[model samples]
Target: MVKMLCDPVCPPPNLSQHPCCTVKCWKWDVNQITMNNLVKYGILILNRPITQNSGFIKNLWNRATIRMTVDGGTRQWDKFISGLSNEMQTTIKDPDLISGDFDSITDEILEKYKAKGCKVIHTPDQDRTDFTKAIMELNTHRKQTGLELSHIIAVAQTSGRFDQIVGNIQTLFLVKEELLLDPNTNVFLISDDSITWLLMPGDHVIYIPEETRQHKRAWCSLVPVGETCKYCTTTGLKWNLDNQSLRFGGIVSTSNTFDGSEKVTVKCSHTLMWSMRLPTIAIS
Candidate 1:
């Protein structure tokens, strides 16, 4: 079983004296299959099959302040709910918005959601991927509605076509430049087996549960994306890096485990993709 920890306002005492401008804290409540105190967050379903357990996805969908689908994801969302019980289907409401080029979604599916009161947006800019365009639409929604969501959880799978998977990651890097999001806004990619997000150059405190740190099969990784990390340091990992470099074809931390600590700290000179395996939990 995975342990749950409350979100602390400040870093723990051990990390209090760390010489970093700002300390970004993270809690893996979603990965641990638990709900935290309701905060402003949105869900963005991509154009992929919803392979996650229905109940789990439903819980997230209901809790999300805003729900959206991109292109064929409208079909995917409809198919996901179609497999649920009548009670479950009724409880899971239609997406608040649907945006993407119409190339992938059929007219019938589009019309169904539109009639259900979903805001259908046609974004035909071929320069950006559907995923990227969807984020833009999400931002626009936030402004128009004054939602001010602090987090965006993108539900996607990592095992699909390699190019699409990489394209999704590229979108993470492009988010800051694409729009003026709050400096603290976080974008996460929730996969079936792992929770991944980009850690910009700064100090970060990621709270991992005690059970996960000690679990034999649980693992985490720090992959430098787009550029080489010149100075990277970490603590609470089985294989901690001490101001070492991490880059492709050189040194990257993959399949690394936690060092029996409830939290993992990372200090990197550049952006690094941090991913951790989800604890094995039986979904009803």
Candidate 2:
């Protein structure tokens, strides 16, 4: 039983902090079957990594109902087709929506997708990142249908300008803030080997599915990104947090090993991020 000493400004401590809360159980009210599975979520493929990726990319391709591309990501989609055989190319699905500042995507690709019944919405707002625009689109669509998205898997390569990579991380938090009241909305940054997502304030349990494990050990991390997470605790992790405060320039949980723990639980005083090394299995 992990007890919490809550910050005054933060809500009253979750009395139901795992083994002993009387008010509410600290468990997420989501179906265990869909937890960490991509089919239940949405996929937003950005240009870089998805464009340069193959094989492993085939694994997570068709799991989401909502599919969209960001800016040059459309160009990347068309480029991806170039690398596939005629049979493989026919199986590729164009995004339902292509959104961005209309800079990187080629006119040819736009014509192609539009011809295939895809909607292309161009926003000339240079004020925000294309990633942000894409997120806004998702938020709006979900709100209209009153459908809560299971999660978001953002596919983008970090092999770019230093600031761009940092901006991508910022995109995660920014979208969370935009959908401020929706606590269940999850956004994940995924590349080839790394996956990351924010663990908002309160209790969080990361369920390790059997399919996500390819070896005996996998690595996971928790870092206080926006503000310091005070009085945080975790279990089912090799180096468990014992009422620790995580922040930069201070103690942080990084490269922690997840050695066959079926469930990892975490509770924080404020919003923070949870990152982990994704399994390398080819999920066909």
The C-alpha RMSD in Å for every predicted model, in order, reads 4.9, 6.3
In model 1, which runs have C-alpha deviations exceeding 4 angstroms?
1-33, 36-38, 280-284
Off by over 4 Å in 2: 1-40, 51-59, 144-148, 180-183, 210-217, 281-284
lDDT of each model, Cα atoms only?
A: 0.78, 0.67
Distance from true position, residue 186, model 2, in Å? 1.8
* Cand. 2 TM to true fold: 0.79
* Per-model TM-score versus the true fold: 0.87, 0.79
Query: lDDT by residue for model 1 over 1-284, one digit each (tens)?
Result: 22322232333222334455354644434433434333678888988888776777888788889999999888888888899999998788789999999798899999998899999999999998999998888888888888868678888888879999999998888885444354456678878756788876667777775556666788899999898999899999999999999999999999898888877888887778998876542232
Candidate 2 per-residue lDDT over residues 83-198, each given as its tens digit? 78888777767688889988887788789889999888887898788888888887777787786565676788657877777888888777656553244556677766666766
